[model samples]
Target: MQETIKKIFTENIQVQIAAGEVLPSALESAAFTIAQSLINGNKLLCCGTPSCHMLAQHMAGLLINFYETERPCLPAVALAQEQVNLGAIANNDEHETFARQIRAFAQQGDLLLAIAVNGNEKQIISAVEAALTRDMKVIVLVGDDGGELVGLLGPNDVEIRVPSKRPSRIVESHLVNLHCLSELIDLTLFPQEEN
Candidate 1:
């Protein structure tokens, strides 16, 4: 068991590193997209399952706050949680609630970040599809190659795909990826210029 755990950890690191290779640019793009949305007074919706909700909250916090920089700090420009919730609502229902809420929340110039592993959840896929239909930008943080999801999320959406091994470790890697995105978003949202 110890050896197995160690092996899993090693694989997780490799997978995380592979995923991180695309993250800097992806993070930059996501930050720019989010900042542009906020500047335009657009709403942002972030949703995932229970564990992913924790990740979402963390990302939201970072996106709405300033990171400590050597120069100075700045205020956030994005809408508050409530403001974001205005057109954004989380789907907690076991049925179609997730997809339905995502569709309702997305609007022109809005952004939706959907977190899922394997992209098997019909509701999430449907939500991404629905959001795309409305011309909303959708980003998917998926755990595998995203076979069908890749097609649905489209080339425009940033798909942060992690390797398929040790499901638990994949989740851990995702948490790390989310943290990096949040940190980058925080820095961009509250740039030192405003300070």
Candidate 2:
């Protein structure tokens, strides 16, 4: 049992290290894009499904609250956080829950961070389309060759693909990526702070 646990941790760490090597440039670009959007008074809209949904909310909370720092709150919203709205949209439109939220809240110059381990979920694709229609820049955190979501990204958009097919490792890598991104945004926005 101890060996199994250690192996799991080792594999996760290995995947995360590989992801760090491959995804830093994309992550840096995403951080810069998010920082510029915030500096311009634009908000960040994040969305995902299941495990990714938790990550989306975590990222939003980190941005809107703080990430290892004492700074003013930044503007960010997790599209999946509103259960009532999501349930209503799911009941009514079935496939347009995230799309509806993106259409309603996202604006030009805003940023959309979409996290998907499989990267082919219908609602996330719909949200991507809606964000594009609103002229929002998109940063996708995906795994497993980026799946179909990679095809949806434009030249100006960014995709951070974790180089692993295992969903658990991919999700773990996503969490690390999210933390790195949040820290990058914090440092970029609040450079003078000692924290």
Candidate 3:
């Protein structure tokens, strides 16, 4: 048992470091793009699964709290349907509701950050296409297998690909990488002020 526990911890740390190596560049690019978009006067809309949406929400919180950017806080507008509780109305919407909210939230200089694990969902792809057509800047953070999502992105879009093959560690690694990104964005966005 002692040996097993020691091996587990060792393996876990190694896996995290390896995953980090694959993630930092993408995360940096995504965070920089987001910070730039907000600095240039763009509201942001993030959409993804419940777990990934939680990540997006946390990212938004970090942006507001640490970056001090005057950006709008709009989260997974499309996934906000099916609310058993009125309090959950804010983040639970169906497809049409998401579309409607997205259309209203997006503008010429605004941005849409789409988060996906598989990147092959029809609804998500469609939403991404719609956002792109409207000329909003797009930033996609998807797992490496999310090739389908990549096809929809244009030159202005930034893509962050995280290698999440291990189901057991994907969520944990993703959260760590994302939190690092949030911290970096905070540092990068506020360097001048900090100086």
Top candidate by lDDT:
2
lDDT rank, highest first?
Answer: 2, 3, 1
Stretches of model 2 off by over 4 angstroms after superposition: 81-83, 86-89, 193-195
Q: Model 1: per-residue lDDT, tens digit, 1-85?
A: 9999899778877877777776667667766676677768776677665546566665655555533444222222221222234
Where model 3 places Cα greater than 4 Å from the true spot, the runs are: 1-15, 67-93, 192-195
TM values, all candidates? 0.74, 0.93, 0.73
- lDDT digits (tens) for residues 1-195 of candidate 3: 999899877766776877777766777787787677767767677666555767666666655554344533423223343333334553554443444556656787777777667677555676688787788877776764766889888787877766655443555666676677666766665554643
- Predicted candidate 2: what Cα RMSD to the true structure? 1.9
Ranked by lDDT, the better of candidates 2 and 3 is 2
Per-residue lDDT of model 2, residues 1-195, tens digit only: 999999999999899889878988999999999999999999999998677899999999999899997799999999864446465546866558788888877789999999898788877888899999998889999999887889999999999999999999999889989999999998898986455
The residue-level lDDT of candidate 1 at 76 comes to: 25
For candidate 3, what is the TM-score?
Answer: 0.73
Q: Which 10 successive residues of model 1 have the least lDDT summed?
A: 74-83
Hey, what RMSD does candidate 3 come out at? Answer: 5.0
Please report the TM-score between candidate 1 and the true structure.
0.74
Query: Any runs in candidate 1 off by more than 4 Å, and if so which?
Result: 64-93, 193-195
